[model samples]
Target: MKDLVIVFPGQGSQFAGMGKQWFDGNRVVRDRFGQASDLVGYSLADLCFTAPPAEVTRTRFAQVSLLVLSYAMYEVMTEDRKIPVSAMTGHSLGEITALLAAGALTFEDAVRLVKARGEAMESCVAESGTGMVAAVRMPVADVEKCVEEFNSGGHDVQVANYNAEAQTVLSGTLDDLKGLTAHLEDRGAKVVKLNVAGAFHSSFMADAVPAYTEALHEVEFTEPTVPVYSNVTGEAHESPQSIRESLAVQLTSPVRWSAIVASLVERKAAVWVEVGPKQVLKKMLTGAVGSGEVHSFDEEPERVRAVLDQLVELKKREPGLVGLCLGAAAATRNRNFDTAAYDQGVVLPYRKLQELSKLDQETLSDEQKQTALDLLLTIMRTKQVPEAEQRDRVESILRRTGDAGLRTIAGALAT
Candidate 1:
């Protein structure tokens, strides 16, 4: 298919009786769940498939159950659909699931890792009275605006997950969450307290990063068979070294879902499938970027069928469109194409030809506009745009169109 993208869920999507669907149909899924239970030194199936509300919802318990169930579900979904994949990506904890899909982690190894990871994250949370909640009905900028002032209110706070434009999550101290909830509601946003137990992806978990790094190194990593976009850097990684570093660093870094979504748009991924229990990413893409063509595995069968119907027609219309893979981006950059087409827009005004000219500060001309893009990029290259300033810097320059300094700055990033 021409347009294929996959997104996986994080910690919040877990529930009791996770593997019931699989266990009721397949013996292999049942056996695997049993093996995971023994490996974790407890019956995960019992707690997940039979336990009461409290224990099943525990952070440690929820993480393992979701991993096993999600992985098994992924396997079943891929059974007969030998659809050629274009690209793959995952969300916070879903990155592990993507790794399994990409052939980097075995199903057994990933389960073991998540089991240990859950224990570590949960044990750390036991010492601190902290939790997480989802804040809705606000843009990314406004959400950050609230959190910036929230730090001054005497609590540790940070953006945990930028799920979409309107649905952002803020993680911080328990009291800080309470304060933000009241303050945000007053601003007309609808904030919902999530059922999570601790401040994941915030500074409260900073103490866990080192042990995570150690755990990451203990396991050997191999380059993925298929490319996967990472959550921490919003870049595609195909090398073993880069994959390991990104996974280890994700403990302290915010989950960059907005960047990941934007990157997919830039790459022209025409279809996305969020392979999980719920349909959050589909709604998120619709709200944030105005595109989805994404469907969940267990999404209402009618909905999934409708999306597949679109994909069928789309593939017939563009059979040769294998997508603008990042490798192709490197190729075009080497051939001087994206910049060339852009350069021609200024130099030749929508023609495909080369113009060899030098730009001077004393003159404002076509070459000047082209070289201006390079100079602005050179300045950005030397100074790292701080986390808080990146969005503003890009936006301010973009809004001030036609001004050479601002146009150059925005063009530098657009390419």
Candidate 2:
């Protein structure tokens, strides 16, 4: 099995019919949804499949729905596909889902916890005039400088989510946010407003802290089966008190997503699967892991299965393929396909042919085979090894293959 880090998504990732396909097709998901509905006192299936978008988008409902759907996806990926989860982390509300996946929280307690937390957040939002805005293409230091400058002038804006290398989310009063946007834009940052009910992960959430903390007391946090990163510290937590405290502080703490990804990379996370309703986390991971393997399970079943098959083979043959594919996926997601950095790693080129030699000719589509070939070509072209020796080695490997398509790719690369 691949060393997979299962990353869950947070708000802004939910929608009606988010997990309808899985619910309709999988008995386990249906059963899990039934239990969640019982615990939360509402048919999550109804709200997720047919409720008005507005209702589902409410903080209370949105949080619950995202948790339920992401949990269902986790069940499908782990129980059905039998994918081993190495470590887990989440963005915002997703941290709860990660906790559940890690076995740190029971499903029922998790449901109740998020429901209480969401209601508290919604209450806070209803009583405050606060929101969040994205500062794009700006480094964290610059965003912090902007926040400091604004807060020094008696404004209340603060960093909420450190989403990526170039993205940061600020939460504060609407008027303050509007003013800060201009200041941020002046500093060469592209500011885009987010449609959130309140300024989560800021001091505005202080009022909700006690209620969330009280609710957390009711839940039992067990030892996790896998390493679970805390959004509060971007590190792993094992103690029950530590996990509980982390969850409460997470409300008022900047989601250290960039830091969490860095930590995962440091541990050599072989593959990252964003098990949620959308591709949001997968996109953020690209810039963070830089040519690491990432995949999303929100697509049609065939596509998901195909990707999983490829991942299994990649894991078995060339683990480094995970990083290459991740970088490539990140590049594709960000609309930048240049692989200059990917070509520079010394060991990447050495095993290029060995990795390609295991491709399943019958299982992979033509385009999939070509993609592997293209990566091999890129890895080979770098000055990591002598061209003649690399060519001889690759040709030797190709001659041993029974795959006609792979050989055809070898011929193309030869000329």
Tens-place lDDT digits, model 1, residues 102-158? 777777778777776777788778858787778887888987888787777676678
| TM-score on alpha carbons, each prediction | 0.72, 0.74
- Residue 222's C-alpha lDDT in candidate 2? 73
Clashes of 1: 0
Candidate lDDT scores, in order, read: 0.65, 0.76
The segments of candidate 1 whose C-alpha lies over 4 angstroms from its true place after superposition are: 289-291, 301-415
Per-residue CA lDDT of candidate 2, range 261-319, in tens? Answer: 99878766767888888799888887678667787888544665666666566545543
Clashing pairs in 2: 291-323, 291-327, 292-326, 292-327
Model 1 TM-score, all chains together: 0.72
